[model samples]
Target: MRCLYLWVIIALFLMTTCPSAHADEAVATQSFWAGLSTKAKFQGEVVSNLVGGLASGSVGNALFIGGFSWDSERAGEWHGGKVVINFLAVDTGNPEAYVGDIQGVSNLTTVDSLMRLYRLYYRQRWGQVTERLGLLNANDYFDNAGVACDLLNASFGIVPVLSQNLQGMPTYPFSSLGSMVALGGGDTTLQAGVFGADAVHPWQQPFSQGVLMML
Candidate 1:
């Protein structure tokens, strides 16, 4: 519950490396994995629970997320097809039990510590329009905030209201089956999608419930 917001904080502080596109092009055709552009990040943080209660002790958490993408156009003449995959892992202490902080420390921290497949989807682009299907995270396409990263609060990663109200709305750490359509110009854009309302892991009973639409 309160442990959910921590993941967004980690996303705000993610670190990465840069490589030449030409360099990757040189090796992309050499191997299957070679064509996949992969990114990995690690994050850690601790939150203090002052004046909350006797259990208001400091707690910490760590996160590991790795993601990779394969461009069908880059792989060959496969046109506008692309595949993406991601993995997220989090470990956290029971700080809420002590401090009763509802906001949580790191968005990724959960009561249970386990690694899971984060996002896996296929997307196709035609000019400015794009279509995506399969396991999806709505947060990847809608209402994203850059300023939220500058602060420690998790609600900054995604809109706090949507994050709290949406039932499934595939998002960070967990994804649900869904699809999205994007049409845009230089300034204004329209994007919408439907995602499973169930927050459970996609690998387990993924389609057992009604779907929720994101507009």
Candidate 2:
């Protein structure tokens, strides 16, 4: 957790240190903006609860998430820089369902939560290529692998394999580096690299593991 905090601090530092220039056009600029988004998710769990003698268990676990997003955009021309902060608190029937549950039980519970930040460093356009960089959300590319693959394979209507339940995924509340380049007049975008997963802790192992593939 301390390492993650340090990475976030570094990212903030870089954002502040980097030089920025406004475009030749004047437009509305907001130093800060606050908003909220709500999401509901369902998860199923099959676990064993240890007892003095034998054991007990349950299934059909569910989860709910409510998030708050804060964004700030610097005034610029067609391309501008931005920073975003996201926070999420989940309601699981049994907190133990999560790896770092508030409670020690490995049962179904609601104490698990996720937080992340999706920052935009800089954006520039040259002909057909538009490039962007900065701390970003892991979900921008990794959240639903199957869904992304499906989108890339839109010609066929086949749905890919998916896991019904998820746990221990890193809640980046702050990821370090990200860069993307678009091609063919906005028809496609190719992402190059990203950073910050190394700072994730064991509690966030699931999410961090997925980032390894991003490289």
Candidate 3:
């Protein structure tokens, strides 16, 4: 994870240190944007013994996300094309291990404590229709409600009844190789996708485990 962080920092440094060009030239050719964010949480078990055993404890952890986006129109390559690269880094410890909550106390909490590529996708749009290929997160397009945007519980972010039962839903913490297409514009639009069933390391096996399609 440290190595991954170093790489991201170095890349950002290089981008920022590049020779300065006219603002119009930068916008007419290509544009790059980078961002880094971290969320830390501490959860303690006050009362338990009903679900994950009679043990009570507390755990603290953090989630780090850093990435960059490149736009074709902004980069002056083409129109309606963009590329995104994102990475996820989880600190040691799982909050659910202490809270023993099925819904999860923190939405950012995950079992894995490592750094990995989270999203790497390219999108192209033609009028009202758009196509995206490569790694993806299903929740970003489906079952997403503005009302629950700030919720911390895992179930609130994505309905557990569906996300939990699905073998590879491709929500958070885990992503899969997939392709998505959408038609229409304005307030009404239609989207459909086919994603790999393997939650972890889907790129290695592709859709060997099967596929999950969403509409």
Candidate 4:
């Protein structure tokens, strides 16, 4: 699979420059304003075959993902901001997971493993906007009438918002809203945000079919 997308671009360039080299020792401590912040990311993608030809066909199909993000700022007084954890480490190849046999199921193997957590939240910023509930893996909110687009920030561009299987068509909506967009500049800095709508149950109904749009 193209060497897992070149090791996810060298693990996103070492998690965006290794945290600015410790950001000056975390700004000289002092309870660091309630410390505890960690982030990690790695991505990969590859798909080539032009059309398909070669016995079992398959000239391209690769993916490598690694993720980790944790926050815990001001952890009291009904909690404040920060307290998230994200995870992703997939390898599409269809060993039985990826996507093969249409729907037959047979432990395929070759594109990606399929495991995402788009965002696990607990943020707070009520003033200029910054509200995160919890349990997020797909559909990072979406409400056209109000004007929202927070599919886990990436400067508002990660290209994810399509779900409709069972004949509906769309597809590619699971795996936590098909997340994949973290390639900015350097010094590492990638924040994420998505809203809610599933009302809560029914397996979160694909994150309420999109409506909140990054609160």
Off by over 4 Å in 1: 1-28, 31-34, 52-54, 166-169
TM-score of 1: 0.74
Using TM-score as the yardstick, the better of models 2 and 4 is 2
- Candidate lDDT scores, in order, read 0.73, 0.39, 0.74, 0.40
**What is the number of residue pairs that collide in model 1?**
10
lDDT value, candidate 1, whole model: 0.73
Off by over 4 Å in 3: 1-57
Candidate 3 lDDT score at position 108: 64
Give the lowest summed-lDDT range of ten residues in model 4: 164-173
User: Mind giving the per-residue lDDT tens digits that candidate 3 earns over 108-209?
Assistant: 666667788888899999999999998998888888875775534556688886677875768777889999999998899999999998868776787888
- Per-structure clash totals for the candidates: 10, 12, 3, 25
Query: How close is each model in CA RMSD to the real structure?
Result: 18.5, 17.0, 13.1, 21.0
**Which candidate has the top score in TM-score?**
1
For residues 122-157, could you state the per-residue lDDT of candidate 1 as single tens digits?
999888898899888777777776456533666467
Quote model 4's TM-score.
0.28
Question: How would you encode candidate 4's per-residue C-alpha lDDT over 1-215 as one tens digit per residue?
Answer: 89999999999988897797577456545344445556664433332333323223332223333344334444223434565665544455332222223332221122335655545556665444455555554333331211323222222322323221222111122323222222233454244444334422314565546543342
Q: How accurate is candidate 3 locally (lDDT)?
A: 0.74
